[model samples]
Target: MIRGVRGATTIEKDEPEIIFSEITKLVQEIVTANNIQPEDISSVVISTTTDIKSAFPAKAVRSLEGWQYVPTMCTHEIDVPGALPMCMRVLMHVNTEVHQKDIQHIYLNNAVSLRPDLVK
Candidate 1:
């Protein structure tokens, strides 16, 4: 079976390094907490707020982790009124034996408030 993990985070600014670090933290946290392996991750779908286009945040993963073989992509989040700005969200689909309810999700930074129940 395949399990999914979702995470959300906000960038302090549009700079590439900042976006890179923040996303790296977010992805690593979710992966580690769930005991997920790099090869087990089917793929990751990342979306950033309209305010962020400085760099491909997904590259953050490749540079910081041993997850180079895992497929990843980045896209723009749909612009909506009153939505969080300068934010990046990821939905990770993994090939795992874990059940959906057993998977862990992460929400950090200002995005933490988006799903208080999931923050650890």
Candidate 2:
């Protein structure tokens, strides 16, 4: 079965280094929480708030060890007024037998507020 593992995180600034670091941390946690292998992931789609323009989050995912071939794309979230700023969200599609309700969804830093119901 294919499962979608969701995750989100926030960075304080738009600097490339910060974007890379936080995004890397977010994806890593998603995989760890879901017990997913890099090869098991079909694709990763990342959307960042408009305030984040320093880098593409896909770069950080592709740079991971054994993740070079994983397909990834980056885009901007809808620019809603008063929406969370400096946020990056990830939806990773993985081939796994885990049931939908059992799958883990991670939200870290300020992004934790984005989905409090999903946070455990």
Q: What is the C-alpha lDDT of each candidate?
A: 0.89, 0.94
Backbone collision tally, model 1: 0
TM-score against truth, every candidate: 0.94, 0.98
Report the lDDT tens digits of candidate 2 across residue range 1-120: 888899999998899999999999999899999999999999999999999997899998999999999999999999999999999999999999999999999999999899999999
Off by over 4 Å in 1: none
lDDT for 10 (candidate 1): 98
**Predicted model with the maximum lDDT:** 2
Model 2 segments more than 4 A misplaced: none
Model 1: per-residue Cα lDDT over 26-77, one tens digit each: 9988988889888888999999999999999888887755778888999998
